[model samples]
Target: MHDSCSSPQTCTKEQVVASAAPERTRPEEGHPLLEPVSAGEVRAEHVLRDTFGFAAFRPWQEEAIEAVLHGPGRVLVVAPTGGGKSLTYQVPALCLEGTTIVISPLVALMEDQCRALAARGIPATFLASTIEQGERNERERGLLAGAYKLVYLAPERLASEWLVNQLARIDVSLLAIDEAHCIAHWGHDFRPDYLRIGDLVARLKPKRVLACTATATPDVRREILERLGFTQGDYAEVLRGFARPNLHLHALRLQPCDQIADAQVVRAEV
Candidate 1:
């Protein structure tokens, strides 16, 4: 289940492994990689560290973020859960002078994300079933007032012609997709609404784009980029393997033990 409660517990080796299957992390706790020193424009170090609280981004986070931050087109990130995915585009969206539309799946998750960002003292909002017309108008006002740096919405909401008109007027800095793996033709339990995202991006005309997901196989990854119409050189794929090592290894041979069966049933119930 998706938890909006908090950053999970200090991930144990087993927990980390279980959560991220392929390998165990060193808990290299710190700010993500600071923006590289560059001429003319700021490297965005303060934003990376102060806003997001990372000493250095994982090997790929910085590269993917940079590709989107300063590039001809878009970037795709396939990272494990809690990989600081939201901040990748959120920080840049805030720094730039435009709105960023994040296409997310769950209404609850969207609200949770908007709440998390708001708690951090950021101007963020979401549109979903939870949003009433008054609140929706407020969100629109926020966007027109230049108060919202990032906005989250379910794909279905894009059907509103009025909303599309608003998008046409906004200087959208980025068009980002979360759970990007859903773009894959063979992705598990594909969401029908996801298939329209590429068209949505084209219409938004954002200066840049970023697609992110927690799980995707090689084939699935390819489909994500293709659906977005990203040329091979136009995007980068940043991925962390799927290997949850925290789970203890266990094996049992079924036996006619009434006590054992009772225990198994109880555990399943819980």
Candidate 2:
């Protein structure tokens, strides 16, 4: 959520990568994951259409989901802000047998996502500093009993040995790192806590990993992959172009006298 302002403002190059939306397609276009599943198998498109109520996958989302569900190892997705990055992992979380643990930085964002998922009949929860101790304990118990399909937690929560030990006992299929650019020193919002994620992954050893972000330079991307224990040949990458014809960028200048005119124009538009 970087702001663009007039005069002497700093911005990341990644923000300029926006592009027109590419043609949307389902995984069945070519991916094996789209094949018809048997009785016990999980079909991704079914989850997309039935669970989330989306007809088709956004550009690059199907490929990213395929990589996570069927690829050999980890996956990294660097899509634009409105590029449906959450589905890259959320869809897989539903298809996979075990739970998916999402590591995010913002408690408010976690709550919002968890609430939306719950409304859609998806079992999701979060534990953050904002919650009361009693409610936190209830969520912890629910998480341990395999009552949730997705669990959102802050990186700080991993510092707790007790919590980590409890998580170790569950069947964690995917470890999704959202806003993954924080792990890189060159990122605009580098965080020291994210550096410990590699160790956490090593200890927890989830079956697969998925790192996602909206903006990242090549150097930052490299640092994130290395930090997440992804080797050159072992992981998959899904990088969608950021060009959208519908998206527009504008910068305007105004003096004290111009404010009145601006207000009048805004009022008319409203």
Candidate 3:
């Protein structure tokens, strides 16, 4: 990944076009959230209650949001599955100017998130191969027109010259990378396409970048930062303790068939 970043010869014309700062419509004319806020002013709590219908932030969520809303905007969040990782970036997306580009790996997850956001009257959309061509075209048009506050994209889509060019034409307020662990070569779920995300970051230069993952070891965490072009001391790290008091672990040493029988008995008891 460092090799690609250092060699300008490896960059394509499309990447250069994507990197060049294009003349964009003033953000004020776009999303209402694009309006500038005074320094030290925080709208995250309000957005949380009003937009997401949440009374308060989960542990470490507010800190992650603050990092994005304030200075040293690049962030890496490692939290458990139910630790409210989405809120860290989602709140800031509504607070900041321009669209938030979310790179999600699963089609189901993207569709579910977009649907949920739409139900809340938030302008969010996703680009995936499962959608019909007409719908995809319409979404692409909406993206270029700055009609959405949040847009979800698959990492593979970043390789498309046309899509990259279209994204370049818009203002990206924040870049949220979900399942960021995949970017680490040593991670259990590593995907080759994820490596291209580093290149995308270089091209888009979003105002802020937030990488979130439920699981990442120290080594995997280091790789994620390096691959995303975040150097030490340059970004904020939000690491949440992985303990869940409500969840209990029980071990049983038994044959596969006996284990199934025991599970059925436990289910019946419950």
Candidate 4:
């Protein structure tokens, strides 16, 4: 149960990177009713129709959303980079009664996600190193006061006494681990903080849990499940494909080149 933000973090505060809504905004003044769909419905009709303005669900979003809304929930989505992993938990959080605690690997992702959720009329916030102790305390207090539906935090946040205490007081619906591959030592950017996740998740007592990753091989996927201690029957890996005919897999030794040109070249290719 997690959301993502899109700011590239620099071991510090996350920055905004989207078209933002005004602070403290709520559902529009007037709209047609978008009633609850079912007991298994994750995103309420209003979330799709009013908040996000999406008329229909995409691919497995509806199925994944339903799975989360139901109990005994754990999902592992191995979708590619653009498959909308964040929506799986965001929709469920919207339908649930409490917050979704998102475990993130990057500060920028948290900022981007929080901004998007905020714009969608979901009270979302983030915890980063930039805030002063006083402001940090205040934000924590405010969030625990039940003003927010989602909280974006780095995996390291779980190590803090303040975060632990604040989390204990809040009602959390889901615990979503984004870039879940980071939990593995074999991962390109292994993070020690990520290894502490399953324990932290048990402490939060969330109703559901979701671990997401954009790129994972068979071994990486197995390692991810083991790191999370997700039993064999506890989760499923939904893989779309492993082939990209357009890509030429090759290693190249390179010397430094113009940074701006390199970026421009890559962008043009995409």
Clashes of each: 22, 7, 0, 8
| Residue pair clashes in candidate 4 | 1-175, 1-176, 4-113, 5-109, 5-112, 5-113, 6-112, 7-108
Instruction: Write candidate 1's Cα lDDT for 97-159 as tens digits.
Output: 668889998888888888888887878888875678898998887777777889897887777
TM-score versus the correct structure, for each prediction:
0.75, 0.77, 0.78, 0.72
Task: Please give the lDDT score at residue 174 for candidate 1.
Answer: 78
Best by TM-score: 3
Whose TM-score is higher: candidate 1's or candidate 4's? 1
Off-target runs (Cα >4 Å) in candidate 2 are 1-39, 244-270
| Distance from true location, Cα of 225 in model 2, Å | 0.4
**Cα lDDT of model 2 by residue, 163-216, tens digit:** 989988999888999999999999999988888788887777665789999888
Candidates ranked, most accurate by lDDT first:
3, 2, 1, 4
List lDDT for all candidates, in order. 0.68, 0.77, 0.77, 0.67
The true-structure Cα RMSD of candidate 2 reads 10.6
For candidate 1, the 10 contiguous residues with the lowest summed lDDT are 1-10
Over 4 Å off, model 4 = 1-46, 242-270
lDDT of 4 at 110: 90
What would the per-residue lDDT of candidate 3 be over residues 80-194, giving only the tens digit for each residue? Answer: 8877888887788888778999999999999988898899999999998888999999999999999999999998898788999888889988999999999998899998889
